[model samples]
Target: MSSARNSYDVVVVGGGHNGLVAAAYLAGAGLSTLVLERLARPGGADLVSPLPGAVVTDLGLDLPRGSRNPACGDLASDLVRAVGPTLLQPLPLERDVRAQVDPDTWRDFVSTPLGVTLEARYADDAERGRVAAEALTGTFASLHDESLAANRGLLYRLLGGTASTRGVAELLTQAAAGAGAELVTSAGVSSIRGGDDGAEVSWHDGMSQHTVGARFVLSNVAPWVLQILMGGDEDPATKPEGAQLRIDLHLDRLPRLRSGADPEAAFAAGIVVGSGYAELASAYDEAAAGRMPSVLPGRLQGRGDTLTYLGTHTPARLFADDPQGAKDLAVARALATIDTQLAEPIADRVVHLEARTPQDIEHDLAMPGGHRFHGDLEWPWAPNRARLDTPAQQWGVQTDVGSVLVCGSGSRRGGGISGLGGHSAAHAVLASR
Candidate 1:
């Protein structure tokens, strides 16, 4: 085979959801666009399982988990226009399903006055979290981190919030391809060169190396990868971090909750375990130091054949257990954690169990340290230091490279599967043109 050379109006690197979204917009705008994917297929952390009986699994979580799909602040309107509303299915959480400890057990845990005050604050803030999630409006960029800092508690609600199903990823792939965008998979980009006139991307297509010339290049890789490819000044000092355990399990049926709530009802809601701010802080500290917390901390949500727990990982991933043993232990631990809040062992109904730790995440998704956000998310209020001072940077999608832009999780709006970065980058490029 011969090396290939292609030129496009825009070249997108990384076929993650953001890249696909950007391609769709750019191609729809009548720009000859091409997307290069290092993976066999697109969707990044949206991993479709190969297990015979396994349902689709995601290495990272998508966002805005609400009943209605809002169009503001999230570029949701643009996404709908590009890919159609059918791409997303709203996950309407009917009620909160966080676990509550017995009065006696709770008393033992919160014997101190400080603990009692912290518990009260946590309870009050949980309601605030829910309200903020419900009241999410406008693009996150418009709100700005500084504005939201007035109520610091809303940050997690926004970060943890999202609304969509796996179909969104598939639809984005189809939509981008349908919009006359050329998608090249298994093409690992080696370097990027950008000038005033245009940008050039070089990559190896497994068999041979190839070069792509484009007027503009959109990167969907992590910030560090971007810095390396672009070969610009100072590399980011912030260490990449991720604290998530993605588990895919097939249950015979929803497990009964100890609270006498219907399992389906509980499953439909965002179930919280280990309530209170103290627990959250402790869990973060433990996970930060590479140790599994005494009590698994996070929220649980599931639909149909899939369930995902956020903010929890296996000891094996933390402590360096054998890969297989680690996964098994993690799955076992997850089930045990779930059992703590349920009437019976949810583990009993498990027909199939699969777990992905930070290690699996790093390997499978090529995420540095398996960080879902790509890197540390800076406050929107932080002084503007990027190459461009436009709203794209506020939205967290701007880059130091003039011709190269970002549309990955590392963008300003915070991570998760929301394609705001894609929408932001595409719009910026179109505006510049």
Candidate 2:
């Protein structure tokens, strides 16, 4: 292959929604921008499940105002009121963000495991589990885990408000293209050379390799991944791994629940399949032991002909020696668990089934452990406490390299469907210019 040295004002490493969002805003702001994507198409994890409002006003696009999807949680009306407007806003995950929240509400959410909080609020395990589904979605923690990751995950999920049934990747892809950002598909970035001057990005398109130079680089991949690409050491401590198993099914029709509830209602509320607090805890414990969980804890979102199952407690490559076997066991457990609540085997309704493991996510999307948010979600308010102290800190995105910035789900004010990280990163770069 010949040496290719194209350049742009800004080069974005990943073409997920956040990348596209940053590209859209950057290109719209008159900075020549190019987005290089590894996947055949963009959209990152397909787990956003919500839309961000900043896209409309800031991007100069009159996109959706509210989700066509239903209000996902019953807690907003009942349990949340009991907690005194706790779920009304995003959970204060960082010590600094806590300033906007009532100190009592923050403590209650952070200190108590979601299951314990639910037990104190509701006596019926069935009702409690239904509410608990939000907290447990995409999380691996058990009801007994002291960290209350469920509480934090739930608070973030609730802040989502409403999302598109189809997700936001395509909408963002179109927006970025419309704004004049150059998007290249099937281009996987292999290395990044960043220093005091501008940087050069090297990538391969299977048959040939290419390099592009840029005055600045904005990353939408995991922060650790960005570091490694720039020749930094891989830190096992901060590197993220994921436990969520996302199974998408195309069914002939929605299965009838053993409880005889309307499929539409259950799907709208997001179905809690085959497990409650104790069962979920047991599954988590079993998986943590590096063995297959007997009972899989998963949530279901479906329409008439399709469903998505997001399972917990199934970590990335659970059986390291037999990775494929581990994924198979996880899938079988997910199907069996779904059948537990169904009058008939869910297999009968399936026209097709696609189960994605953490390994697949890592290999395909370049996420460290296929973690949807890049890593464990954390809280940070001040620049002094975060990973970086550059102007990018204003929006919470960080990277050690002065010319490279992060704008992925891992960024602050951030994660999943919201373009807030991208919006902030764009501002930082534009401000520097």
Candidate 3:
């Protein structure tokens, strides 16, 4: 057993984005706070850093197209307060993502069998297929979360929408340090013991075992990780399954689109590929059954001028039905799929290409099952569950354990790259004081 050291007002476990955010706020409020990170850095999984040997400066990419979290405003506001107005800029309200599919096929899918008349603005088959899929799978409803639902007026005022600086963790760490918070990297917590009075955290810093006491303990790890630390049951239901494949492609130049639209304009918009709604649903079902999808659905976006990243959740061809192999193959397959949708050969535009498998994501980001949302996303309004106001249990920050809080993506308001989970956890700790 490690001996307890001097007590602090708060001791945060994990130095990811959420943990750093909480540390900054807690220290700002004059609380003596200390942040312990397992990794050498503090960004957690949300940070988008440049790949080695890559020349591009900006590495942080936007969330998948069509993904909107209501907590975006809150996170942006907090970040602006921590950094400065100049470090952040407003994101556009315009659609950042665009689906690329055969328009004629889409038109036919939506219209009569003879394809007599058009019903939508889409080219042809793609729109009809999407509409049909949406109708069958309730994809629209599934995409929107009721709990973290966005308020249009408030969202409009959030710096007119914003973009994060290159390195989000670095910014937050600097802000927290400025606020007098102590950040100890390469420190892994062994276990934590807390009660109604306070919390004690035991960790190893590679040199020796050290124990610290605090009025409150905030965890920035996945819930399952936390459960293991506290000797609790690791429920299988909470485990998240990630189907998305994250890819980074350094292209010589943007590929010519089949639509014949301006390259700049097309690059600015997001890219989506799939047969339609039915294909997406089927791919999802296959992935859910521990198999790769036959269709290989994907989303593509151009980051900066040189780097174009394409991510696909569905794999058209799996090597032996293995998820890992499928993820490994996704980048090449995604490029090939995009090639079919483009007027030019995309494979030839490649400069440097890198791929991150779901397993890589799980290990690199330290996310369980590689879920960006931390655990399975809970409906904002879970039926029959007591919904607490913001900054409480219902918000997914506060825990049943006394003064033990969660400040990561697993938190209720957490998902995507929004820092709301950390901000909410910090506010809750502050309120208690």
TM-score of each: 0.72, 0.86, 0.69
The backbone clash count of each candidate, in order, is 12, 0, 16
Better candidate by TM-score, 1 or 2: 2
lDDT of 1 by residue, 1-433 (tens): 1123378888999988878778887888889988888888887876321110100112122323333222113412222232222112111111210123244422322222222323444466444333332222111111112333212222322333343345556767877887888888888898999975688999887788888788889989888778788875544354464556777768787777788886676776647665334444455466557666656654566866566665443322374556666556556656676777888887777788777777778788777667766765533222333333553443446666667888776765435336656766777787777
- True-structure RMSD, every candidate: 10.9, 4.1, 10.5
How does residue 38 of candidate 2 score in lDDT?
A: 90
Model 2, 1-433: lDDT tens digits are 3222388999999998889889999998888899989988988865565455546666655466544223344443322333223211222234545555565555656667777777887888677766566566666677657876787677656655533346667878888888888888888898999974588999898899899889889988888898888988988887787888889999888988889999877875677675676777778788888877898888788787889888887887584578778778888889999998899999999999988888887887888887877876654234335444356655566566667888778776555336666777887788677
lDDT for model 1, please.
0.57
Model 3, runs deviating above 4 Å:
1-5, 47-166, 233-238, 305-324, 381-391
- After superposition, candidate 2 runs with Cα above 4 Å error: 1-5, 60-63, 66-100, 112-116, 143-148, 162-164, 234-238, 380-389
RMSD of 2: 4.1
lDDT of 3 by residue, 202-229 (tens): 8898889888899999888888888877
Between candidates 1 and 3, the lDDT winner: 1
lDDT of each: 0.57, 0.73, 0.57
The candidate maximizing lDDT is 2
Q: Give the distance in Å from residue 375's predicted Cα in candidate 2 to where it truly belongs.
A: 0.7
Model 3 lowest lDDT segment of ten = 89-98
